[model samples]
Target chain A: MPHLRWARALGASALLAVLLASAACGGGAQPSSGGNSSGLQVIKIATQSPLSGDESVQGIALKNGAALKLKQEYDQFKAMGFDLQLDPQDDKGDPNTGVANAQKLAADSQVLAVVGHLDSGVMIPSEAQYHAAQLPIVSPANTNPNVTSQYKYPEISRICGRDDVQGPVGAIFAKDQLGVKTVFVIDNITAYGTGVANAFKQKAQEIGLQVVGSQSIDKSETDYSNVLTQIQQVKPDLVYYGGLYQGFALMLNQAAVRGIHTKWMGPDGVFSNGLVATAKENAIGVYATSVAAPTNLTPGGQKFIQDYTAEYKENPDPYAIYGYDAMGVVLQGLKDAIQKNGGKLPTRAQVRDAIRAITDYQGALVKVGFDSIGDNIYAGYYVYQITSANASTTGDAKLMAQYNPKGELVSQ
Target chain B: MSSTLQTLPQLVLDGLVVGFVYALIAVGYTMVYGVLKLINFAHGDVFMVGAFVGTEVLRALTAGGRPLSPWALLLAAVVAAAAVTALLGAGIERVAYRPLRQAPTLILLVSAIGVSFLLEDLVRLVESIHLGKFVLPVPTVFATVYRIHVAGLQNPLTIRLNSIVVVVASILMMVGLTLFVGRTRPGKAMRAVAEDRTTAALQGIDVNAIIALTFLVGSGMGGAAGALFATQYTLVTPYMGFDIGIKAFTAAVVGGIGNIPGAFLGGILLGVLEQVGGGFIGTKFQNVVAFAILVLVLVLLPSGLLGERVQEGA
Candidate 1:
């Protein structure tokens, strides 16, 4: 019995040591409490995605984008009464991390308004804390409708379109634009993936497009040759992948190798230039729908792109645009709240109210916006076609297409 | 069916390319196992350290505003990584394995786990910030030169110059190793030590020198694998070792523990199996296939593919 107890204690100690070491080595995974330092007005903003393992690209983009915006706007922010600063944390794209980050942010009094929890999985767990704290969080990229759709409180919001809008648009384009009727739908079997795929399939079925096959693949998968072969035999004209760019890119490349000639369509996860770079020629004819305008083509997007390129010397990722715009919205709301509260920095509740009260605020990309469910009210999606001429073309198909519910091309 | 068949050649070709890289990693695992009769779990991290060391060396060369040629950079990377890895491996053995020399098997294994944790933490502590994080930047060999292609496919199968170098260097190292082990005095001492450590010590073989040499050789292989793996995969993170380590261990076990030839065979077979499984099943279960093969092989032939006889007394 003593031996057994000793062994158990040793195992526990070893495990504890490992976790503590991991935390120390990976940077302190501590919950930030807004320390009321005498001179520094420390404000924390956070975004969550898979930061540690795979899907790290998207997470990195989200983090850098938000950080860049905060850095750029810091001088102007300090000129005002509040000494604005930004604190970013990693969620590692897990819901557990999302919850932890959210709780941490909520607990910190300096965190007035938050920027992200990129994946819907992370957002779902963190939103409850944000709601209870009345801390407004604007998701730059999360597309799942449940993110804000069924929220008990409306403090949580997103700048991106819901999967309901984006998914249907993708399905309509495949059926109408690409002449892909008998189609297969494949989700990555996550909240975001399944949600978008379901919406696409439902809309496609309604439009007389036969949903011939549907399946789920784990997110970490890099090959889809076997599934592609099965789909090839089914002779589907298209395969709808409701996953992020990482899995989607691999799937397309492998499918191309397997000679699966079907057109591939996905939502915003396939929007990154990194996705295009990885997929290469395999990504040709692939399509993804975005609720917001493409950053390269947006009105002020060109300026942001030039500024970002000059600053980072790397091309500004699309998600960065949303993040920049998200910070702009929060700043605008905070400004309004500060003015309303007689030049004093408003309480967390006042800031949350200011965000809710926002209307017709012009932003960097478009007007600053939110609806009842905290989704963008002016929901417009852009359809991009990857073609032999390269998806980054200056042609008709490459131009953002506006689509209505019935699959007719609306005037862009 | 015809299209899928056409795709097979391309898939297999790429699979073999990846397999060669895996074989490089498996060699280190097998080498350590051969002499120590203990799996150096930290071998994969040694590969990671090599990549990091290469990064530091290349970055220094480029930082002086004199961008070295790809060949120069590659040479610098190889030498720097080899030196760093050799030191790291030796240090790890001295700190973690030395104390456990007469301990139980479980303690040695535990020490290996501790070493892995320690190395990971060390890397992470140095690369704390994400912005200036350690990135294993590969030379533009893949993008610029030695692009492979099939006539029909639109996408050219890109086999990078660096990858070719990696394969060539690995082969040379293996050949050198075989020659050294077979023909050199220290090599024979190493073999003798593996056969019977007490007897080798009685025959006037410097036990400490041989042990240090074992680490040097094993970690040197790991370093080469690291540079090659980084060049081929095009991404290197501190935690990258854990997954690759598991794969390499599986390769070593499948080939036969403590058998150098078996490790090579095992790695190639594992890589081919992964690609074939992906082609047949889907990419999602690619990891499952590797482990499944390990289990199957262990059940049927515990001695591994090379059929090496195991002596109980070390």
Candidate 2:
């Protein structure tokens, strides 16, 4: 009798929970339509990014950037009797999640191109699925050289410059610009983090800067007291963190708490509003080398800033422009492929080839030309010093210097 | 080796505060396991809920334009988090556990996991809808950094005032719960229920009420820990609880499941070991070291460091 009573109660509560969860899920689910012979041939450009974790600010903006592009071009495509849809997939910034999302997106025949994977670590692994599906992905932010150089997957390409170049840019900037002689490096213990850190270390050693020590931090963990103490002990001229913005923010704050105020620098992964907001006053004077060029400085970029702010009611993250450029590359490829195929929806291979074939194609922000291995020939890197707490939000950090894709300094 | 020795104090100091938090959440796991013989897998999600609640309260207060003192803001966050999470824990018990009170252990375990998942998704849903972003960064309150110059250390040992607040708050909660369970009448009744449920019921003690009381107290402590954790660590996400929860659960097990003081000991031990090991080996291996220490403890002392104490008290 007691058992039955409890069972009935359990069933009722479980049902209520199911209903609530389903409603919540329903709110997030997009209407995924099948590829049918409708008036407008449907095409989905998927974005793989960490839409929900620590990196969500950058990832979401990356997704939004691509989505905004798709939205804008939707009318143009529709006029040409083609449907352009943005499929934003939450990778959660996990390799497994990204791979799973890639698998799902890859299986969908309608998904011809992708514009994402903010983390190179996520991008590297997920590229296999996209390659198998012949789906071309134009990365908005992944900078690890291995992302394109190692894999050499024509399906994989990024609008952002590689970490090898970005790393040295920071090293050169540190030695030449900031006048820091000794450097201590730390990574987020991620593929992207470790890769960038190694590159920076290599360049630091080559440039005759003292490489005191290096520490690897798990990106998920919050506490950085141990590393902070270590940093204090070594007394580096500058502390370079090759990690995401969130980890860099914590370390910067933690280091500040300990009076360990060596100059702080990071790769583009640390270029976001979250860092400034979280680190607050601690973030000021910290430098981050971004794979993105200054967007507000360009006229078209100004319009993009206005349009994106008006559309999303949020200022685009630093990588948002990268996402716009990535999607721009993909959309260009899609258009070329469609035209090549006589105004018909091209096969996935056609899109992949067309994307890899891009040369001198200018997006709203960056000019893109994919090398044979899908490395953007015209990718430019910029160093920005956080002059204000809201620098990342406005992408208005003081542009310290610019670098070509080859790590050659282009301007002061 | 000298360098490692040099950073030992910093490592231990860093570990202690987090260990106290682990102990706080561990007590929730231990208490529920003691009373109901259930792991209460949802406890971690409960902790996450508390973090969100605390963060939201701070956000609300900050946005209200009247800036309160740091301590006051912290107290508000902790108290609000405790209250909300206490209710959530009780509600979870009522809806999820009470219904399956007579079910098999595996069934109860399943229900616990289901509740855990449901709570995470629910929080995620609520946060996503409300904030349009589920990763809620905790607003700053206590930003004062205290530097202690220890003899033989080149760099002064830096301690965050917030971390000290967390440790003091955790200790206070721990002591309060310890006293409540050891001295109070309801506490004795709960212990009796843990000892023998049928006998406790026959002795004029409401067994269900005692169990629910246990959940409320334990969950309140966990929520307070969550609030403290959010304050010390500026980021709070829906999935944040899973890793910390596992570590806390490990702390409970190492402390000897169902043992209160053991959870404390286990938490501190695990935290120190993790940080020290991580400091030497690598920070990436902190979890590995913590769990390795747990396995070593379990293998050497199967019942746990304070398993003997578990039988003496709930």
Q: Native contacts retained per candidate? A: 0.09, 0.76
Q: Each model's DockQ? A: 0.10, 0.66
- Restricted to chain B, the TM-score per model reads 0.91, 0.97
Give chain A TM for each model in order: 0.86, 0.94
**DockQ value for model 1:** 0.10
Per-residue lDDT tens digits of candidate 2, residues B1-314? 89888898989998898899899999999999999888888899899989999999999999876579888898999999999999889888887898789887678889989988888877887787787878777888897888888889877787888888888888888888888899999989989999889999999999989989988998988898899999988878888888888889999999999999999989888888888888888777877887887899899998899996445423
Q: Rate residue B39 of model 2 by lDDT.
A: 87
CAPRI-style grade of the A/B interface in model 2: medium
User: Per-residue lDDT of A127-229 in model 2, one digit per residue for the tens?
Assistant: 8898888889888788898898877887888777888889989999999998998999999989899999999999999999999889888888788877776
lDDT of 2 at B101: 90
Evaluate residue A242 in candidate 1 and report its C-alpha lDDT on the 0 to 100 scale.
87
**Residue B235 lDDT, candidate 2, scale 0-100:** 79
Clash pairs, candidate 1, are A49-A93, A50-A92, A50-A93, A51-A92, A285-A386
B1-314, model 1: which lDDT tens digit per residue? 55456446545655666677677788888877777778888888888887776766666676766566777777777778888898889888876787678887678888888878777756765654534444333333234444356787544454446556777777887788888888999889988887778889999998878987888888987887776666555445676777778788888888888877888888888877776665555555666775787789888998899947787554
TM-score of each: 0.76, 0.94
